[model samples]
Target: MTMTRKDIGLATRRAVLGDAHVARAQEATTAFDAPFQDLIAEGAWGRVWTSEAISRRERSMLTIALLAALGHDEELAMHCRATVRTGASAEDVREALMHVAIYAGVPAANRALKIAKAVFAEMAADTDQTDSEKGGDHDKG
Candidate 1:
């Protein structure tokens, strides 16, 4: 049976990425992009992401590599953002970039790395903001 938009979005977001990453996506959604957001959550995250054949980790690696190969910086950044949910380590991402360099060319990999670095920095800043809102207790303990 087809799932409701809310359910599909929630499930797909959580399954492929994770609750934290999905929450960020939800927070960033705007009225203009709401429909596009829903479509992707259901189609990309829900349908494709929910598939059982490939593990999330493997999917993440494949996604990063493919996006880089195609020089699809935007999608690469998106998948890089989702890597946290897919259990992909920093090392794993680095390995994927290295492979992209070998197969896709250094220029493609370089651009992807730039996007990935920016995305990662943004994620870190978000985490810091959240921590500060919670009283910056993470640093104390």
Candidate 2:
């Protein structure tokens, strides 16, 4: 069966953004923002992210760079966290932000880097906690 745009978008958004994040966003949505959320799910996540022209990793890099260039710090941080699911490495993020430094200016890149660092740290910590809870000693032999 052919998937609807909302179906495609919801799946794409969850894959890229993670179920926890998407669930939180859905929970936080109000009547005023519900339509806006649907629009992004259909347009950005469905149309853009599901495009075959680029890999999800490439899209993650581009999204991060664009968010940084536009000084969208919150979205930049969210995308940085989403990179864990998108397979966009920290090195890729560094390179993308380097481009941002030259084209979007040093200030924007600097702020983005700071945000990326914090987000990475948070992700690492979460991973460590999960591993520990699973009885895995990730830090030991």
Candidate 3:
């Protein structure tokens, strides 16, 4: 069976952003912004992200840097969290933001770093809670 672009895009989107995030976005979507959402899904995820020319890790870093440089803080935080699925490590993100500091100014990098730190911390806490729920490290006492 051949998957259409929309299908491929949605699959790629879920793969990179995770199901929970996508679900939240879907839930938040209304008729008002439906077209905008479709554009992002088909354009950004399908056209840009689905390209194999660059690895998702590289893409993640690039996206983070671009978002930071553009002062898209909310989106930046979302991308920072997406790094978990994108395989872009914290160090990789930091390096990307360092480039932003030079090219996009220190203030942008500084703000992005702060947002990334908070997002990473939240991700870590979520992971810890999931692990504890699964009884991971329960014997460490």
Candidate 4:
């Protein structure tokens, strides 16, 4: 049977990473990129990211490092956000960037670090917002 877009997305996401990570990706995908997201769900996520040859953590590190090396700041930022769901730590990102600095050049790593820092800050703000919402709910109850 042909895989539906949602099915492809669900399986691809869960296989490459985890449910939480995929959920965030789905949430972050905007109206502008919804079509692109669908394409990725079928092409990248469905075909490649679901491969069993590598672990999710390894995929996360490699994806971030490569994106940084290639100067794909937006993609790097997206992957960095997904790293949280992939069970990667900030320390892992630091180590990856250090390697990128050595292998990919200092300038690339520098830019990647700046991008990651901003993404991380945004993530922190999102978390704080969620916590505040939960607090508001508790107060109402």
What do the candidate models score in CA lDDT, each in turn?
Answer: 0.84, 0.94, 0.93, 0.85
What are the per-residue Cα lDDT tens digits for candidate 3 across 1-141?
998777788889999989988889889999999898889888999889999999999999999999999999999998999998899999999999999999999999999999999999999999999988778567665
Q: Kindly list the per-residue Cα lDDT of model 1 for residues 1-141, writing each as its tens digit.
A: 876865875787776666777799889999999998888877777777778899889889998999899988877887898877788976788899999999989998898888888888999999999878788675577
TM-score per candidate, in order? 0.68, 0.90, 0.90, 0.73
Off by over 4 Å in 2: 136-141
Lowest-sum lDDT 10-residue window in model 2:
132-141
| Model 4: residues with Cα > 4 Å off, grouped in runs | 2-10, 13-43
What is the full ranking by lDDT, best candidate first?
2, 3, 4, 1
Which wins on lDDT, candidate 2 or candidate 3?
2
Report the error of model 3 at residue 139, Å: 6.0
Candidate 1 vs 4: which has more lDDT: 4
Global Cα RMSD, each model: 4.5, 2.8, 2.3, 4.7
Give the per-residue lDDT digits (tens) of candidate 4, residues 1-141: 987755776786775556776789789999999988788787777766767798777888898999999999888987888887777877798899999999999999999999999988999999999999999999999
Global CA lDDT of candidate 4, please? Answer: 0.85
Looking at model 4, the pairs that clash are: none
